[model samples]
Target: MTGFVELARAAQAARQARPQVPLALATLVQVDGSSYRQPGARMLVDAEGRVLAGAISGGCLEGDVAARAAEVCASGRAARLMYDLRADLETIWGFGAKCDGIAHLLLEPLTDWRWMAQAEAVRGRRLGGAVVTLLDSHGGGATCALLDGDPSPAKWHVLHDDARLLSLPELLPLAHSTMRTGHALLHTVADEMTVFIEPLVPAIALHCVGASRGAEAIARIAHTMGWQVTILDHRPALLDELDLPEGVMRRRVRQLEAVHSALAELPHDARSAVVLLSHIFDVDSAWMTATLPLPLGYVGVLGSRKRAGQLVEHAEGVLAARGTPLTARLRHKLYAPIGLDLGGESPASIALAAIAEIEAVMHARPAGFLRERQSPIHSRTPSPRVLERDQAPTLPEVPLRCELPEHPAE
Candidate 1:
């Protein structure tokens, strides 16, 4: 989400500036092995070989991709650039990086700005969506980005429409699967043309229920990571006194009665997380009880193990009285002694540990050292290889139109 945001902001600025230098969009369509970035990663480059925004690799492939972008802009045609990173690390062409993989990128001229508008529109909705890109053949480099409830009847907004690509009945199913599973898929249509289906989910939102120094620390770190941060407190003075970044939001609510309404107005999706740092027993208790029934992914309380247990017990009694049961699923969402066991007593160290834990839990990963893990650092599910038509299961049909727009000959 952060990568895409950077790319979008840069591209939008470039468009508004109306630069004389032509621009190109580099989409990392596929990866054959372990790499710093996965498929669906993108970078925007200019005719002068400057990287405007985003990154395809950890500085290894950007230089080469930027050079290719110059050619793509000049020719006015999309070019498929492939890099074999499995060579010697010390070689001059290797960029001294140890990325032993194959990266395939689709470099296209950024003549059509409608795709940019569509991307911004979908993002503004704060919902999940899938982007389908035609990678080589059948209007290669055409992209269709639509949100969950787009009003436009046409499913795709691209350079031009291609009849052959539209005839492929399996395209829509593959895209639906990508959105449902929240995983990117590199697919081959009829064993000839290639397409990439990538999912776009909203950024993680961190809700700080207190305006203390600890909350300020967490908000600073979260803002740097591009997560939405909101600081809330019953006392408006504390919120005003706390120094926070520009985009961070501040809200003041009256005690228990307003807690429910305040939380209801904020993000309540699985991507949202709430942390109780008020240090006030009654305040934390009221917030905990209010958040239990919501669909938030993580709910952390800053206190000792004993205090956490006591809050849960109190929440249970309150919920039982209101005829709402504290189910196991809801209990699993609570992290009583908030944050990871990073061995820290200071507010700064404690904030670091909490943010790290939230990231791990949100991704459903075990918070442990990379050296101790045996499996790949990133999950390589749905194989990067060309998915066979019969091999990939057909997900249920959806309203999405996966038509590939034809890239008109220059």
Candidate 2:
């Protein structure tokens, strides 16, 4: 199953285990002007008021949501929250927010586990699917359906819709929009039309090799960034000593063989990033050489540039002899001497750089000083033209006169 579906299933299972528990489902209903999260983004909140599935906003909005979730859990009622980052100076300052847009969050109580179960069933089918919910319409409720068969140009059926029945052709376009939050499809058949859409779950995963302090820091930051983190280390003692979040998975594996086995088990997708900080040169080298050929989102090596060059050379020689072609694309994907140019020697700083670089690569952005780029720092507004044609002065031509004062001066 996909990560999003698994998260939904997990949250559903958690709620099922404790029927009395109240769950709040926070979804991004609208994105006006500009915002961190787009429409249809969702985060599941547990009865304890803890975020179980996704992130609504950054840290700025989570705390308030947690508090409000507690209240909803206690009251067993749904609530709608609208956070406008551009409200007042005091309001923005109080929330520690600076976004110039508005985000609408629907914190609904998950009192019905049956709907969740049905959603899980649809997800388990492994087919392209969508969940359509009518927030304020003639048919007001959430319904999920699976798109049977491979996604093609043709449309498919949406499993559950009691208010209005839709054919395959009518629902396919809606499925695509359902990948984002609050996106809907208005289908016109005969004289009537129905709107169907839902939010998409974000795809992100974190892989940490070695239980070094740097790895711990990366895991912590990645967790906050809404990544499913898995920590693999040779030393069991190191794993035991580390303080990691509950979401992070720790695996005890020794030697390069174990590393290869672990990587082979992961789902190869663009949403996954792997970081190697094994300290041991031979182990790190071996893992890199073996895994370089595999399709992965990002692969980072923790070491000096000199050491990384040596390792790359060794891998190239070995792979060449084995008749495996190691191309430039593969080499570039291998981030040796990982992280941005933070210029800090400490583990924490190194960790920061590593995570930053990973994020940069994942987002297809360059890891450098923002001021150096011609692109806008945050928003994508077109740069204003300083010298427009109408604004430029059309000076009249003037003949130059040469003065013969040299003889007189002499």
Candidate 3:
């Protein structure tokens, strides 16, 4: 979502700088089997044929899309370009496409204020919304509308391409569905309008439940990736000592029970994760007991397989003592010994492995090597939790700052 917003901002700026030069946005709206880029991926092009912001494919389709975008800018109309790489062994556009897939791109000249409005929507809006582009308009001539789903009508001021409002109350119902499915749908509304509704949700949140060394790595990397990270710990001393990157929220709690209310109050969805990195049995046990009931996207504990089983037993014991029954859902959602087998003993490698697990879960992807997976290298449907254009927040990547402590000298 942020990436699209950035493109919007860039588009607006480019338009402002040259006022006369036209710019167009080509969005990869739909994809068939074996696409390098999935639906919701975007690429921006200008009248001068320069690619900006996003890419629709791995250097295979951008040239053609950019040419189409140049045509859209020159013609001042919206257009859709369909590419079928699997059609034949050789053809124009470089003697057969490499992806062996099909993609539908909605290319529209960004001449109106709607792009700027989307940029603003990405700025502060959090409730999640969608932009319903009337692709049938065939480019600049068609209408684009934005309906922010988070707030009521007061905050969600609709904008149309022609500077006049169109009564699209029917879109309100679709907004709910878009947010739920986290995918843009090409729907035929009243008056035979074909609008692509793309949902915009909040960034993924990772609530780290300890200030251990592993916790620092998680916070730093997740923060760099634009995830909303909240470092929660009972020990103020340890929490303060953690050198997390900017945008990481630090919460100081006084007891194990404090986490319950904290977790309850957090704004989370299926993309959120709660990772236990306290490294202490009592602390981890208390957190697991408290977290197992919450409907988080992931509940991970850092430990060995045997330790993971033991922790589950401890959590069940703790919950049973309180007469709380652990649900099967907890078993399904929890990733004990959190993270993938990246096989690095260093702190940074461990952190990478842990985040990789969360990423896989968020995308409903199995954690395995690409060579081992027979399916396409890129998954077509991202995690339903991810909104259109919602990449990491706009922040510089954080450098690896963690220095693992040396083992005791012989």
Q: lDDT per prediction?
A: 0.77, 0.62, 0.70
lDDT minimum window of 10 residues, candidate 1? 144-153
Indicate whether candidate 1 or candidate 3 has the larger lDDT: 1
**lDDT-superior candidate, 2 or 3:** 3
Ranking by TM-score: 1, 3, 2
TM-score of each: 0.87, 0.63, 0.78
Query: Over the full model, what C-alpha lDDT does candidate 1 score relative to the true structure?
Result: 0.77
Error of 3 at 23 (Å): 2.9
> What does candidate 2 score on TM?
0.63
Query: Taking the tens digit of each residue's C-alpha lDDT, what string does model 2 give over 50-114?
Result: 76766777656765676677777677555667777677324644544456777766676665434
Q: Candidate 1 lDDT, tens digit per residue, 301-347? A: 99999999999999999999999889999999999899999998999
Can you write out model 3's per-residue Cα lDDT over 1-410, one digit (the tens) per residue? Answer: 34565676676677777777788877777677787776667777887777866788877777767766667777777787777868632554547655567777788777653444453445334667666566554333243555544423333443444312233244454555666777677666444555566777567789888888889998888977778889988889998898878778889878876767787777556767889888888888888888777767889999888988999998988888888878787788899998898889888999999998998898788888789988768654442343444332333333112221232221
Residue 329, model 3: lDDT of 75
Clashes of 2: 4
- Give the runs in model 3 whose Cα sits over 4 Å from its true position: 12-20, 68-71, 86-97, 112-126, 137-143, 150-157, 161-173, 190-192, 235-243, 369-410
Model 3 worst lDDT window (10 residues):
399-408
Candidate number with the higher lDDT (1 or 2): 1
- Which TM-score value belongs to model 3? 0.78
- Error of model 3, residue 304, in angstroms: 2.5
